[model samples]
Structures are given as C-alpha cells and as structure tokens.
Target: MFLTKIDTLGNVVFSRLLGSATNAEAFSLAVDSQDNVIIAGSTTDNLGDNTRISGTDSFVTKFSARGDRIFTYQLDTVAQDKPAAIAIDADDNIILTGFSDGAINAATPSNGGRDVMLLKIDGDSGQRIDEALIGSATTERGEAVAIAEDGNILLASIDNGRAVLRKVDVNDFSNILFEQDLGQINNSGAISGLRVSGSNIFLAGSTSNSGFTGTAASIAKDFAGDTDGFVLKLTDNGSSADADFVSFVGTEAFDKINDIAVGASSVFVVGSTRGALEAGGREGPTDAFITRIDMATGAIEQVQQFGLLLTNNEATGIAFTNTGPSVLDALGLPAGTVDRIETRSVDSQTTAKAGDYFDISIDGGRKRRITLNEGDTFSDIARRINRLSFRGDVSADGSNGKLVIRANGSASVDLIAGEGSSDLLGKLGLKSQRLLGTDALFNLNDDDDQNSSSTESDLGGVFAFKLDGPLGLQDRQTAAFTLTQIQEAINTSQRAFRSLSPSILDTLGDQLGGSASGVVPTRLQSQLANYSAALSRLQSGSGGGGFFI
Candidate 1:
C-alpha cells in the first residue's frame, strides 16, 4: 500500500521496499510540474531493503523530477502513529498529515495511538521543515493537507466529534492563519480526503446523518434510495458559509465517497452508488460514480455513473490530465468543459467621438457594446456609461476631454479600445485586433431560437460589434487615443487580482503535492504553478524557462 506511479501502460515506476514482510500503504500522492512524485502514509511495517524502524512509523518519500526514488525517511514520535495523507508546495516543499499517537520523541516516539500531526519536508531530501500537532490534547484525525500560494497550509481533521479545519503558516509553522469547525454532526466520521482550489476546500467522505440537523439552506438527502455520500466544501477562512460551504449528496441508497481531487476550477469525487440510475441505458443496479463540480459556484456540471454490470465496480480514485476530453469525460464532466480554454480573451472596441452623441446596443440582452461618435458630448457618453453601470458593478473611466468610453457591471473584461479609438487605431492595431477578436469569439446562441436559426453556435449566444469612426466622423469620427492608457487602466483595475490569488495558489499547491497513490494531478498542478511562478519571476526579473515553450 505504498504510493507509486503507473505509466499509461500501467507499470509501477515506484514501489518502495517494506521491512520483514510487512507492506507499505501509500495513502496519498502528489506530482509536481517537474514530474517528481511525493507520497505519504504511515508505515506499520519497517521499510527500506536493509534496516527497518523497530515499530510502526509515519513515512514520506520523494522521487526525482524523473520519477526515480530520491530519498525516504521514517517520522515517528514518542507515540506510535502513521500519516494518512501528504502534499507538496510550489517550492517543492512537502506536507504530510494524519493522526499521531500523541508522541514527541527525538527521532522516533515511544508511541501512543492517533492524534492529528503534521510534518513538512523539503521535496529534495525528505528533511523536516516544520511540524505541528493540531487540536487540544485530545485525539484528532487528519486526512488531508493543502498549502496556499503565500505558503499557508490548510489541514482538515476530525476533532471534537466532527470535521475541523485549520490554516497554518508554511514558514515557521507558528501562527495560526484561521480555524473553524466543518458541519460534522456525526459522532466520529472520517474526513477521508481534502483538496483546495482557489479559496475553496473540497472534502469527501460518508456520514451517518439520519436526522436533519444541518444549517439553513442545507438540504438533507438520503443516499441511493436510503447511506449518503457526503461532500463538503469549506472557505479558506474555515467558516461554515459566506462564500464557502458547498455540499453535494448522492441519491443512490448505497453511495459512499472513496476520495476527492481538486483541480484549477473543479473538484472530482469518486464513489459508489446503488439503486435506480440513468447510466449506460439502465435504470437499476449499482454503479461507480464520478461527479465533477464547478469550483467557482460549486455547481454540479455533470455526473458520470459507470459500471452497471461490467468495468470497475465503483469509481475508486479520480485523476485529471492536460490531454483529451475522453479522460475529462471519464471524470463525469461535460465534454467541452476543458476545451473553451483554447483562449478566453475578449475584444471589445467602443466607438469614440469628440462630439456629444452616444449609443449602446444590447444584442439579445446579454451582450452589450457601446458606441460614441461625433455629437457624443461628454455628458452623452457619461450618461450612457452611467446607465450601463449599475450601482454594484465596478466601472472604469475611458474618457478624457470629450473623448470617453469604459466598462460597466463586469470585473473581467478586455476594455482595450472599445470598438473605435483613433489613437488606438494609430499607435497599435487595437481596433482591428478588436474586430478580429470579436469575429473570433462573438458566437451567438440563436441556433435554438427560430429568429437566430440563421446564426451560429457550437454553443449559441454570440454577437459582433461594428463601431462608428472609420466606417462613417461627424461620420461618427473625431476622437483618438493610445492603447497604452487602456492597458494601464486594465493593469490598474486588475491589481485586485492578487486579492483572490492566494486560494488559487493553495489549491494548486495541494494538486502539485502528490503523496503516493498517484502523481497525475500533482504533475499537472506543478506544470501550471511553475508556469505561473516562472511568469511571475520573469516579470520581477527572477528568471524562467521562457515563453518559447
């Protein structure tokens, strides 16, 4: 039961040797961008072909960027114990969690039983970096660990007769970032798995909740037809709700969660479901289920239930790759979920004019693009801008003198030179670029509507914008400006991005920290993190692999 990597062809690239006939169980795994695998789980048997630890001990292993075993170490306290899960950070640091026997020996402990414990090590040599035992003296169980981008670690445990969560610093491991209890009414249920994405933490396990004692808006669901697989999501702050607290239940009477994996924008759960289902053309029997949740809104995008009478009995472990939709589909996500990312750039060009004339068009009511031409007095543009901007949405100023334009109601935007800026058209081809970009992305969903039957759509709701200026000045032409101001504005408005960057980092860190079972997700997260870290470093002159890749 040790953590190991299997190639697409299914071969164990890593299988650590255990002591005396006792086997090693790899409870968790993470793979970094460098392709190195980090595994953690307690070892009841002595390991290493030669000398083994005298008693059951916790262990962490590291592999080279090439997947070769680099180092291994046994971690034990005065109390007897084992780690249940482990993770890695952007800097290749390791985090191992699970229960400790409440021991505190120098090298190895005398031994107690199971109290929540944490051990962080360098991915290069498996050396301890920081250690902490969460909870007050009483027994606690930790099944997962996640490190935020700023180097904060989030640990999930079963404490005080319920699931508890904690946030700790990665550097000195001293200050507690935050801590709170997860809604765990069950007596002593296990928090089997934990993975963070953005600011959200996804937890999966089975709970005995026959009585409906959850908070408001919490729906009580009976599993299959009767043992529900419970999945809970928490915020980085460890609160019950307030933008955190996402929960999902399986309807099949026999479904129970085995584990969970966190991705950039989604969470995956592998579990079992029994009773009537709508998979493989059948409506009855047991099936392995893989459910994908949109991490942003905790929305259940798709459900994939397999194995009616063949294939794997139940979904065991769910993993994701940067490859094809088939694999993503296997995880129960809608096929196109991973494909829209081909490019998410938006191009919007607003018409500009020194005169006091303004025009804003809402195609199908969802797509709005503004147009301002000659006669567009400062007041006209301002009025249109004001109308477009609701009180709650953020807006940017694109007007100076009588030349004006900007965005309303959207934090995410490509407010380059909205449709028509003379200076933008001169200094850079921003206007044309906007046109080309619009043509590329302005897809409409008119395909479903008889009126839009002549429209386009792999996924409808697309539109295109044609501004005034060159096409007609007083012909709607007059104003002009540089794209630099727009870029500056965007750069300024986007500073708030860092506001949400930490959660993204923590979730990414967890994915890259492969414990043992598999390195697939870790490798994916590492590649993304390194890509992000490299970009960040490059911007700060730190160094990087370059954009040539």
Candidate 2:
C-alpha cells in the first residue's frame, strides 16, 4: 500500500510505500478527527510486525497528520478479504466495508457466496466492536460507503447485476434504515462509485441501457451508445417514495464513469471513454474525461477530455471538500427510502397452488390482502404483489425457494396467511418474525445460524440434540434413564428419519391418504401419540417430570 500526502496545490508533502513481502493494494482512504490519515486495503504478506498475520487479509493503518505511521492492524479471515470503502462515524469509530467470501469475524459468518461485510473498529485501538454481513444468494460486494448527516451509513453495492443502496443505523447494527434496488439498465450496471450530497445520492458507472427497466416511471430511460457512462441520483432520506433520475452520456463509444463528487451546484464525474464522443466537448479514443452536470436538471453542463489519441488515461477515484446548497431541493425531495424484506424458505416448494393469499401489513398499520391468481408462478405472484404501491416489492429468493418483499421505507412489514391462504407462511417455512422491516440480514444454511437464529429461527425449524459420548453420565445397565440417554435416543430417531427413503415414505403416505397434503395420517398420528406418551412415562420414570438415575 502506498500513502502520499500532497498540499492543495498538488505539491507532494511526503511519499511513503508500506507493504509486506507480497503484493499489497490500497482500496480506500479516510481522515480521522485528529487529522490522521487512515488507509484500508488488503495485504498478501505480513508487515514484518508480529501483529500482522499472513494470508489475503484486510488491513487498516493509521498515519499521523505528519504522515508518520502510528498503528496498523489486520483483520484475518479464512478466505480472501478486501476493503473497498471506509468512513469515520460520529464517535470517531472507523467503519470499513468490503467483500469477503469467508468468515468476517467470530460472530459474523459468510452466507455462502461473496457478501457485503461492514465492521466498526475502535479508532484508538483497531478492535472490532460491531459488524454485519449482508448478502443475497449470489455474490454481493460493497463498492462505496458514506456517512449521512443523520449518522446513518449509506452503503452502495452491486448484487448480481443490479445496483443496491442500503442505509444502516450505525448505533444499532440491527436496524437497516432502508434498502433500495436501483434496478440496472443493462447487464453492466455495476456500482463503480458512490457519493452523497445532502439528501441526494449520486451513483457513477457504465451501463448498456439494454435491459434497463426501472421500478418507477419517473426514472428516465435513455440509452446513448453501446456502453455509455451513466449517472443516477437517488433520494437518500428513507423517503425514497418515487422520484429518481438517470442520465446516459456518451456518443457511440465505450464509456465507463469511475467516480463522482458533488460540488455546490455541480456534479463532477471522472471517467474514461473510447472512440469519438461528445459531452462538454469532443473527445477522441482512449482518453480521460471530466464532465460537470447541473445537479438540478441532470443535464451535462460541461465536459473536458484530456490525453492524446490512442493513449489510455483512466480516472479511478474522486473527492470533494464541499457541496453547496442541499441537492435535494434541486432534484426534488426523494420518493423516500425503500425497505428490503429478504426471506428464504427452509424447504423447497416445487409447485405453487392457486387461491393462496397473504396479508401484508406495513408500518404496523395498513393491511393489504393479496390473493394469487390461477396458475401463477412465484415470479408471477411477485410481479402482482409489486403492483401494489404500498406493498413495495416482492421477489423470489433464487438461493432458497422463498419470497422477498421490500417495503416502501423502513416500515415494519408483516406477512401472514389471509383467510384461505392454505398455511402459506408454513408452506414457505416463513414466520412472522422474518418480517425484516428493520433488519436486512437473511440466510438459509447453518453458517449464519449464530447471528440470525434469533430472527430467522422460525423460518427453519430448530431441534434440540446432544452430541455423542456420555461425558456426564455413567454406564447405566439398569432401569436408570438419564436425560442424556433420552436425548441420545431422540437424536438417533431424528437421524433415522433423515436417512429414510423419500420415495418409500411417499408410498406409505399415499397408502394412508394425504400423500400430497404433507399431513400426518390418522394411523401415524395415533402411533406418534402413543410413542410420545411412552417417552413421557419413561422421562417421569414412575414419578412426575423427573429423570431418576
């Protein structure tokens, strides 16, 4: 990692390169309250210090105002980890966000693929105080992070091919202030940069404009070229109710906007373009271009292209010290912040039945009943549910067979079986606790069990079991029935059930009727009841509710 300090006039004050035996790359930088320079990146080798660990781990180093290295610490994980963005919170705590494929910490575990990881480390001592791992079934990476005036952490990420924005309350990591799916315009609508100007959020990247279908009509649908540079401005305050603007700038060329910064009334963008293009002025192939857009109109105000033809001039990052006036007034109040309610099924449902209805309650008030149409697939049902303005958005979880509902804002959402919904929640393995209006973390497997069990436990059933080997129990060859013994027997039975042949069980259920109902037959129910009574008696052991040894 290299750290260079230069005066405002572009004069180098100091230059230093710090790394390990292996390659080191710095991705993000921030300034602390005490004028210390903070850099976050990934290192392949140790820093020669005993405190540094080996492997591809994320590192945070603090340099004094005079460019003297003060403290350096590494965040080690099992797999490759990289810090993409960093910000300082209200309490001087350093907030780092990036992509991690492995465990983030002892408490935060990965949810299968690459996930967006956030950590709040103590500024004075680099000790992690709180962290969160947010991801979908697919790979999700955090590209940028900015602190809102209200102290909320605004994170910009790309999941699959869509751009995602999340507002999280730093004080309460569990509280996901809001989530917005700024649906991509093309297959290449990845997040390259993010900037916050008051209540408006500006995203810079390149898009194909081929499949750009925005959620609302207010979003402009304009494609300029094969892969034209695009800028999206969204309302940052939770009230992302509706109005958002998108602009495509290019002239039959390959253009990718790498970074954006907001000034008093202008949105400054730095990017690279190829072939002849026009924005503020004409540009030739392989050149770096800086464009200034009017914040109020979302129009290209001016563009300046540099570098000679056939020369590659790329701009990676940009920053601004001040942005005058509230950009919200010029862009109009943001529709509002949208809430993402992500859910997954504990079990898969191969088919969908008609007449399945569910009730959606928002903000602990306003209930909307949605009934499925005949022959409607999960995707079709999601489309129908999204049509309701108050319901926000509903989509299917591809990772696990489940449903995801996004509310208009961070409104409390409740999903339950409407009158004749046919155990809809139960079928989906969903419960009221998975409402997810406040929390944004969701997972399906055992890896995320520790962090999400309290909220998503009902989504996937829980079983109490004991490990093999009797550590606290003696060899009882007599009538003594210890609790551990009972637990062992229960575990054995559970394993037996898990090992049974599904086809054979289906045949037996078919012979007993209710084969497709997922309901226990009368005969099986009677047998289970008798076995339960016998187990209860065995537990009481001639006494009552007491295990005698």
Write candidate 1's Cα lDDT for 1-549 as tens digits: 434445443544434332213445667777776777776755554433232345667777665543345566676444566777777777878888877665544643323335678787877766677776665655577777777545578787777567666777777665777776665546545566777666666667776664422232443233343456666665554433232434555663556778888877777887877743344542336677777777666567777776645543776677776565466446554432222211111110121222212133322134344444433344544555556646523233434433333333223333333322223222112331221122223223233432222222212222222232232123111222123223333443343343334456567768867344554567778899889987776577625655433
lDDT of each: 0.54, 0.65
TM-score each candidate: 0.51, 0.55
TM-score of 1: 0.51
> Which ranges of candidate 1 are over 4 A from the true structure?
1-21, 48-53, 65-67, 106-113, 185-188, 210-226, 237-245, 263-265, 277-286, 308-312, 325-549
Residue-wise lDDT of candidate 2 within 1-549, one digit each (tens)?
A: 468766444555555566543577888888978888888988875532343344688888876666555566677666778888898988778988898888766677788788888888888876778888898678888888888767788887877777777888888776888888877644456567667777877777777864453343444436666787777777655634233777766667777888788888988888887745453343344778788887766777777777664557877767764333466546644222222332221211221234446677655666677665544445655665666553453333332344666543334556766442244454444565535432221111234423232231133244444444223444442113344345545655554455443456667878867446676779989999999988877776764565654
